[model samples]
Target chain A: MKLTIPGEELMGHGNLSCQGCGGSLAMRYALKALGRDTIAVIPACCWSIIDGPFPYSCLKIPVFHTAFETAASAASGVSAAMKIKGKKTTVLAWAGDGGTFDIGIQALSGAAERGDNIIYICYDNEAYMNTGIQRSSATPYGAWTTTTPAKKFKSAPKKNMVEIMVAHKIPYTATACIAYPEDFIKKIKKAKGFQGTKYIQVLAPCPTGWRYDPAKTIELSKMAVESGIYPLYEVENGIYKISRKAKNKTVKEYIKMQGRFSHLTGEVIDEMQKNVDKEWELLIRKEEFYGHTKE
Target chain B: MKKVVTGNYAASYGAKVSRAEVVAAYPITPQTQIVEKIASFVANNEMDAEYIKVESEHSAMAACVGASAAGCRAYTATSAQGLALMHEMLHWAANARLPVVMANVNRAMGPPWTVWTDQNDSLSQRDTGWLQFYCENSQEVFDTTIQAYKICEKIGLPGMLVLDAFILSHTSEPVEIYDQDRIDKFLPKYNPRYKLEPSETHAFGGLTTPEWYYELRYKIQSAMDEGLKEIESVGKDFGKMFGRKYGLIEKYRCDDIDTLLVMSGSTASTGKEVIDRLRDNGERIGLARMRVFRPFPKQEMRKLAEDVNKIIVIDRNISFGNEGIFFSELKSALYNENTDIPVYGFIAGLGGRDITMKDIEGMIKKADGKPKDIIWWGLK
Candidate 1:
């Protein structure tokens, strides 16, 4: 099937985001895939600020900047309204990790359970970047945020949001990253085709918050996938398909690229590797259970 | 079309006539039937709206906010715990200035977990910057719901039309449903002056520095202050179109009265009946039904309270450990005014108990003399 990526820039230039802000890039790519008919339900995140002040916005699409936790519900509403008007417009909820994993979980779960026709995309930069890089549930274990300093790095593992979304038996759920623009665009276009609730988790790396070289943002994301730290996969109708399977690389390669994880010692690094390996094992099991490898 | 409907049905019917684009709601007691009827309307294609069956009340409001922001009129109904669950998003819908209309069936919040009628749920969100209107009867419930959209859009604020749970939500009465064509003329299609449009570049709910934060908040306040006039104008227009005039405060037989009974919601109907009986008996007792609660009709309330030798406030909701919520606001409104009459606060019909005309008579009798800090009525 030929991919029909939007050629027009619905999200225009001159945004207020920092250079190489992953969240802004995520929105731009998402708009390119979803098109001008897409309505973005933005929660309280950096994108809310990046959208620019009132009477001045960067995006050319209709954006409803809702509360911190209301993106999912708001998207559901917009979808319903479109259905009412007999308009086949896509309602996309663009939120950050803090909005998705923490405050917005309830609304997200509700929308997912009801199978409300919406596309919920979470740009996972790992922390609440808008609130001064505070640790969120999406923050990886052993990562250091302002709230969880080097002395007291995050102890809890990052919540498995894609699995949770798949558990709702939604039409589509996928993981994408900025490093793989084609794959990211492909997944978004595929998501647009699905009928019911569709969710996309994009691993958007923030240079300022992650304390990495702004130019290396895409490189870090690529390393994150190659090192098996952030595997790219898609779940459709309970079937899991590993979209990108990279050669196994050292977790240290992914960690050392960002200062947030610089505090991890050998033991903590090993622990992180063990956790990633265990999660990968589970994904492989799911793939085996659902995808059924060709003979 | 006309029907003998309950206040809840009236609200639902009003929403139906308004051609609400989306109806997102979760079922809670008292308010369940309101959404049930709305759902049936959508399911039957009687109303062209998407009836979103959300998991919780919080999402219900969130969905309405989304629909409104998408440049479509949206509505939802909830009571008590459902309203409490929607507390945080209520502020969001208001601040985002989405002209979403919600009908809050006033019920007490839970601790022991009661679903009875009380004003605590809506009153608790007094500072949320949404326009709040209380209804006295099925007619008002139906009329106010239609009028709220106009007021909300005019002031760029969301509106909450509240009716007492059980007392108003379930009770049946006479309500005239207007023709859809007439309603269309009265409430033209919602054309939001400012909305999220891809063709136009504009931001919403963005970061505000200290320099602009206060100004934005003051703008909201100024809009609210101007809303009073807008509300009155809509009320008059609605009356002229629909033959039902509602105001910030609806006065009853207050002329040449020495004592007045101040109340809101269904209980005001009871107060009116009692006031009529007392007037017939040659007692100088009158009734003041407060229609608009938030943007608290302060000046009008004070002017109305000035001539009365004694003022009695009947509140169906309490603030717990303090006087009645409405009473406190009333007292604040009358504070420093030249009213010599001693103000009395009477808490009544808590936990959804029926407030009869006899209860109003008792409250009127008690108000003839100085009463305690807060007198609890219908406790037995």
Candidate 2:
């Protein structure tokens, strides 16, 4: 099959997204790779507002702005319908951390378990930006949102959604970041080739929610990967392959860039760093275990 | 082919003959056998459809929504918890106006988690805008499943074919499985007038501003209202071809009866038997079975309630704090009428308990002795 990366900007420029919003860029690049044969299912989040109002759509493809918890199931339906009509199109469910990890977990789990032929991408911005920056299950420890102020920061670690996806024994699962555009696009394109359920969790930095300089969006994403906070890896048929191995930058480099973690003291930063290191080590062991099993 | 078959198999056979292109399913008791049969049909190449084994009922409905939006006829089946899980997507399927057909094996919602027959599961979603049809027997289950697709596509609204859990879902009855050729002649390929195609760019699930939101809702309401007539016509056409006619409401021995027993789903069969037995013994008792519940069948219900001095509604589902869900709708439907009939609501067979002819006789006896406001029958 001839591969044609879309050159047309289906997601038009001059939208209302914040400067260098990683979520906005994720949609832009995803559309480029998937082409016009795509329907984006967006839930209640920044993208829902970013997609522009009715009669003036920002993207060229049809977008189904669904309820906060329905993106996964809605996308699953669209994908099944497409297969029935003999239309080879990708149904992409684009949701935020709050939508994916909290409200929409049941629907997401259902779609994954059924192996519905759909690509569900969660743009993890750490917190709910659309609903006034509330803490979500995906919010990392020590992060500050409207719900978790400096007086009471988030105590729990971010929910390991990748592990949950792995439990479903889906055909494809991967972690990517908007900072690595090539890797993110590659994972999405690779997911399209597989026939069953595929999932990708992309670390999208929110300048508004994270309280960061708008220009540091890409930089923060890169720091997240370098610090091993977000590893780029793919799980193909239960075989884990770490696509991008970090050079191991200090976690401080990633935390200092975001205001959500600005209130953390030296001890809290170190604790978060230790947690990140432990998680990264476990991910490495997983890659080794799954890789050896595949061989 | 005429054969003794479970209600689940009859519904599965109906979907197969209808040539449903997609079936997204999650297993819930009573409804599980229906999907299992459909899966076997797909596996055996008896049907050309994508069998999506979803993890939850919510996704099952979601997958159906996607398939329907892509311009393909989609099918799914669930009961109780599964139906509750798909509650959110049920509204979306209707609001999106996708002609997705689902079979809800009606089961009681639980604090007890019992897997038994009840109308609460489907009736709870009464306001979701999808058309609801209750089946009385295996034959109605088969015919209604086929007729649902036609009615749904005609009105561009999703339709649910509901049967009493355990009673119809597990019980075996004689059903004539219509041939594929006959089904093809009756239900042509489903061609959706509005679909999510890239060639024709249109907004779906877009932000409906104040200017058109109410109008869009009113249109859906009007579509549902129009569906009432469409369901009756389709039922007439189906009966003419298959030699079995079904109206929005099925009336029996109500011509001169002073008291009418109103019910829906499989228990209605038992009610009919009870009514026949009573009629033979010089009792002026009749039965009214509601086939269509969404458009409410207000006209037919009024006509049936007109001559009756007392109306007894047997509901298998409850609305918790309120009376029987169907009974509330019935009372509201007849509130303004000048009829002097005292309508009584009876909640029975909840949590899948068997509603035998004895239970019907007991309820009819109670209604005969000064009809109460709401009676909880068959309770321990």
lDDT tens readout by residue for model 1, A208-273: 899999989888888888877889999988888898876477788889988888878999999888
**Using alpha carbons, what is the TM-score of model 2?**
0.92
Docking model 1 quality class: medium
Chain B alone vs. reference chain B, TM-score for every model = 0.96, 0.97
lDDT of candidates 1 onward, in order:
0.86, 0.85
- The B-chain TM-score of model 2 reads 0.97
Q: What's the CA error at residue B320 for candidate 1, in Å?
A: 4.2
**Candidate 2 lDDT, tens digit per residue, A1-295?**
6544456787886566877788899888888778887888887889877887666678888887777787888788788778767889788899998999999998898788777788999999889887788999999989999999998999998999989998999999999998887788888999999988888999998899999899888888888988888888999999988988864788898888888888999998888888889988999999998888878
Candidate 2 docking band: medium
TM-score of every candidate relative to the true structure: 0.93, 0.92
Question: Residue A258 deviation, candidate 1, in Å?
Answer: 3.0
The parts of candidate 2 lying over 4 Å away from their true place are A1-6, A13-16, A105-115, A163-172, A233-249, A277-295, B281-283, B352-362, B368-371, B378-380
